[model samples]
Target chain A: MKSLFFPVLLAALLAGCSGTPSKVASIEDRSVTATETKFVADKPLVETMGKPPDATSTSSSLPLPAAGRSGVAVETRGLVAPSTDVMGLAEAKAAEAAAKAADTGATAKSGGVQDAAILPYSGGMNQADMKDPASLLSKRRVQFDYDSAAIRDEFHAMLEAHAKYMKTNSSARAILQGNTDERGSREYNLALGQRRAESVFKALNLLGVPEGQMEAVSMGEEKPLSEGHDEAAWQQNRRTEILYQGE
Target chain B: MTIEIVGGATNRIPIAILPFLVAPELASGTSDPALVVAGDLGRSGYFKLLDTSTVSGLPADPESLPLAPWKALGADAVVVGQIKPQGSERVEVRFWLFDPVRQTRLSALSYTTTRAGLRGVAHRISDAVHQALLGEPGAYGGRIAYIVKHHGHYELQVADADSQNAVTVTSSPEPLISPAWSPDGRRLAYVSFEDKKPVVYVQNLADGYRRAVAKFRGSNSAPAWSPDGRRLAVALSKDETSQIYSLDLLTGDATRLTQGGALDTEPEFSPDGLWLYFTSDRGGSPQIYRESLSTGKVNRVTFEGNYNVSPALSPDGRTLAFIHRRDSQFHVAVMDLNNHQLQVLTDSTQDESPSFAGNGRVLLYATMVQGRGVLATVSIDGKIRQRLSQGGDLREPAWGR
Candidate 1:
């Protein structure tokens, strides 16, 4: 566990040095910057750092506002465990000092390492959480089967995360842009894509996202994620993307 | 553009079109009208162009030409024309069609137009010859609207029937698809994704003035004009998942035409304005269905395959063309409204967006040729076929009057 924890600590230190907000100041900014650099280079830096596993559990354990919130949070934890690993802090004290030093040298920072230590129990999201790889809000794409608008079971956790974020952030707005593979008529596919987007919209609404905060739209088969004319490409093309406004 | 004639009628009329004598002053500005006429006729698959290479001199007029030589060359009909400068910027084009065997003139016509209008004049002559011989109006003098994708941009282009004199109506970094022409051929309605969502826009062809006719909350697409040109039937998803709605052009009021949980789109109006046919998946699969404008009654039209969509009705409202999928390969098919008999018109695997020509004798559609999109036309009887290919990927062809 110590062997695995060092890289994540080093990554957080490097990410803090790169002028990202201190992890103590914002857990959201540190994780987002770490993943953004991971896509460019430094692949091994945060490979073992999974999502914050206890976030959903702690949110569910709180005083429940809605009847469906607890059930959804539990299901989300189940679906999010296997595919994504939670960031484990084996050496929390040593890593926190290093992150503070890097953050101070990089920029004027506030909310020292003590704030980062308690973020896992907060289950709160700001604008930076949308880009954080550890946040369920970062999983924006929801895929569907061919000729289907039914949301798959695997995306339940991601949807719940977004729903919680929307409920917490009242001023936020989202646009659901749906897409499809190039198999059928262009107009028909447009309708199909609309159906998929509406399905996502309805799901979010049922989870308490307001109607005024969301809009559903279709890209049809015109905008394809894969250009190949095969099933593998088709699977990737049939998806709905959750886009936040002013982000 | 390159044209390939796949199959043709066996008893094609053997006709020879002699080189038209052009005035020296007008020669530099205009193309050879005879070549244009020959190209229009030959690609149509109804007439066989006889060789005119060995002919000695260009005929000044049909009266000065000898029919004996053309008859000996196995030509059944002969065409002769002459272009003369009528004024400073105008030229007079005259053509005479004669039957070599009967030794009599079939028809003669003259048109005086500006030098820039010579191509239109050539197409009109082809139409006149086609009418004189086949007793039906030719579609060569019409325009075709389609989408071309090249250099990472999409352009909506309107061109002549022979794919010449093309003008881009709109170009964008995003996609533009499903171009539908109005009944009067004065405007075009198509779907554009410039705003990160599909919205229907109608643009005037002459002045390029465009308006977003269906910029609703959700996806707005599949714009089909009514025969009277007063309204457009579009598929919108503002209230539900893609239901048909009629938008009044004058008042911008949209009335819902279809209702259900299932998806319904690709609205097309009948020529008589009595029915609105669209694609619906209410029966568990995509199929063509029509709703009565007066009664609002719905009935299924196609029951053949699991997928039949993008219905394009003929001018006479007697035939319906759509994309039908079989064994995972999409093909264009036509259905007779009276008998409900279906006939698949194409053999290509990836055919789509079938639009009938102005004459209703041929259907133009887009298909994949070795992973590239190209436009193709086939006769109503599934006999003759012609492929029209250009440099970029072309699709969504709508032939206008």
Candidate 2:
């Protein structure tokens, strides 16, 4: 009985030890997986996290069970490993510990420990959140209608999340690339694309993002996301993509 | 490049271009001058080429030629030429034009040039023939600059007026568009996206030295050279939504030429530098508008259509060409600047970038045919048209001398 108990405890400790890195690794892999799953299986996740994840959001306080912690390890296998695979894994474990502490209602202890772990990462949590599947930053593109630069209603929440991130992190810079469908004059389309990107730039500025941290430019109708000449393809081509500096 | 002539003039001149006699040694080094001249006149839509292949022998000169047979063959004018080696590197080409109906010598000329310049010499001869017959300058001696997209790479190409002898001026993975030639024809101002943003660049065609002229805070594009070539009018969004600004090339200072909240772009200068015509949506929809440089007076140019953009003025400043949309189809249309009479010049559904030839008798533009971009030219009168296509997608054609 002593031998079996020792092995079980060691296994539990080992699972706990390995679980942290796996979670970090999963967060690093989220950028690719999230984008791939976005078109199909991630609609529900988007709907659930449609609003910015606030301090009172329960999704941030949910504790991962032992089985779910181990399941993260299995999910990391098929992903394209990033350069900071080990560090990401370690940071993820810290995040998981903080989440567990919060679940136990130890807010003060969890806050201190989370800050301490995140200080060594230097905006690592923020970057991970950007790549998080449930984060609004993951949805980078804002679609536009034909010959219109008005931002759609569905993207306000996502834009707000990005605006909040930029406001909080002053060093973060973004380039707003605007595009247009292959219609009308190319020079005119270029102006139209610039208008689209400026619309987003103005929206972010109004939401408290500094103008110096953002740039607006036009790609014109030269770079089309879809090659078709029909309306459906044109719809996809008209958009603005928000890109951050240094990943 | 492939050429397709569409439509013809009502009264075409009947001309015969006979094969040129070549010396034994010069035969291998020279291109057939008669063939080049025949092509120029044939595609001009003003002349109808009569067959001269069945003729007996090449004429030595006007003294030895017989106009009786050409007259009997129903040829109104006859052209005969010969090529002979002049020096180690140069060749002498001589040609004579005879009036078959009048049974008299109309004109004669001789040119000495390198073997490589033989095509240019032939084009000049065609120009001479055209001027002697129609009393107007020919557009064959001009060059054209356009953009070509192949295998996801964009290239700026400079070619002859006939779309031959194309030389790639610049190639980049990023896009390059809106090529505008300077008044001197030695430099080209265009928009390039190599730095991940649209920046206007002016490049010298001779040495290929380029510089970013309008690299402002936001997008800088739609560069139009002033009549004096001292400045460029560009559209920038640094201050507000895309507005027109005049940028001085020497000092790099930009003066806001246009104001207000509407989007204004595609700025073009009139030949006299008196007015600046551009596309603006301040009137609710996109339309062509002109602003006086001396006075800030503004006038809407296109009133019949809600969508009219990309305004290009003729060299004489009497005609304004633009892209007009009708029933969801875009076509190249021209308006008499004086009379305000508008006429659509093309049948293609997707046409853009209409530029006038040096003579102002033809307009060079880009249109989509079967989902592929091709360069096309239509006469000012809308009686003649030609399509030029190649392996890659061609667009943004600017004709210059």
Candidate 3:
């Protein structure tokens, strides 16, 4: 009778433990679940929560249950077993708690300071490939003498490379973006950038690049690479950016 | 521009043009002196022509340059010329300009032109006389500034009045809107949204100096300078109304000029300093309006286009050049305030900003070509147009005197 009574009590306790949710398993609805997506998926740590016992819902199931509920966190406080596995489980639970606390803390104060829009570059091309002088110079940027649109001779190598790339790669397209330094009026700059981009486009088309593969755009003086008040910065800003569209 | 006169007729520079130098063979049958004279003087823009009938009693020769009769005819100067065929496909042209007020020859010159170049000789002589009377160089070698945009971003640029030497001045990382120049032409005041909000910045051309001028709450855009350079008239939202307000550069105090819920922008001061010309959507689509300083009365100036902006008031306050959207593209157009005549300048390019030179003969505008913004200019007559393709493609050029 004593052994039967102990077994019956254990069964009841186990049933109750499987009914409640774990403390760390606070799953909110509408939050995206694990998936392959276009944007960055929910931060990596979001799905590290353990599955709950007897909870079939994949969308919103708690990790652990209370003592009165099924699949609650392992209740070592009242457990008769003094095994090391239980102790290891307890350490894991503690570590997860600490990690959650730290994550929340870091997120709360991540205010925007470096707020200037960084150039949006998410293509397959990496910085190393771009660092090669040939590749770097191959970028469709042309420099002009002050107050003149006549193409200079120095950009020949770069433009020729771009033309070659365009001729060889049928699927690749390039957008030439004309830019200017802070010198004239906004409207004037916009028009000037357009003129510069058009000149480059015509040059490319004349040099064997397909007319249909290249498009010209004028950003005017709005996009500057260097943020200085000096002439060097101005020179750098006075450039045309050749953007690649899916090679 | 506000031109206030005691009797309601403003002051004007009285002037005249010389007769067109026609070959003796061309004018062999006719002795009409008026037709010859009108062509030369009208092109100069320095003279208000007096009718040959008004000076009906004046002598035809230079010695008989009847001073009393010319004065009665409102003639401030007289021009006499001789054109004879040189037969080398050329003609011998001799001309002299006389100041009727002083009764003496102010200047004289001679030129030999090929038969086909006779008109060219006439224009050059007209330009010379125009320069002499105006004391300032004629508008023969000047430029205009205006605005232009491609897919994104605005460019304020400068180009020759004939649309040559188009150069970009301010290329921003964001959209640039209005561009106005200081009276001295050293700095350009324009609106750029670099901080993600419309802010006015004055950029110095001499030393790449750029700094925020006004960052008021809401929009601090549409900056126009007073003729004296002491104040900047801009459209602000601090009053919860997009009204015209003048900001004191030294003290940074903004003074409201209009009080209403109507959205008012594009404030340009009349040359006389007594009125402000701006655009308001109060009645409907954007139209140019003038608000009197002394009387606080508002009057509409533009009626043809549903959309018009970037008004460039001629130095004499007689003409207003602005942009109007038509057929899905904007083109620069000028309005004769007295006659209310409107003329579109560009064909298909999106002309964004337009400004006039001090002489009021040249206009600078910005337009897009080949996807980049470029500055262009045209004479009000719509003839003698050229394009300026300066490096770093530009837009929104403001021409100072």
Best by TM-score: 1
lDDT of 2 by residue, A102-129 (tens): 1111011110000000001122334878
Clashing pairs in 2: A20-A93, A21-A89
User: Candidate 2, residues B1-401: lDDT per residue as tens digits?
Assistant: 88899998889999999888888766643569899999999998999999887777755554469888899888888988777664344556777788988988777776655555677677878988898888888888778889888767677777778877665555565788999999988788888876667888887665445678888877989999999999999999899879999999999999999988998999999999999999999999999999999998999999987899999999999999999999989999999998999999888999999999888889999999998999999998898999999877889999987
Candidate 1's TM-score on the B chain: 0.97
Q: Tens-digit lDDT track for model 1 on A165-197?
A: 999998778889999999879889999999899
lDDT of 1 by residue, B120-237 (tens): 7788889888988899888788888898887566777777788875555565657899999999887889998866678888876644446788888989999999999999999999
Cα error, candidate 2, residue B287 (Å): 0.6
Residue pairs in candidate 1 whose N, alpha carbon or C atoms collide under 3 angstroms: A50-A85
Docking class of 1: incorrect
TM-scores, each model vs. reference: 0.80, 0.79, 0.43
Off by over 4 Å in 2: A1-126, B62-64
List the candidate numbers ranked by DockQ, top first: 1, 2, 3
Candidate 3 residues A33-133, lDDT tens each?
11101111112121222223334446532223333322112100000100011122235346445642221110111101112221222246333434576
* Error of model 3, residue A233, in angstroms: 32
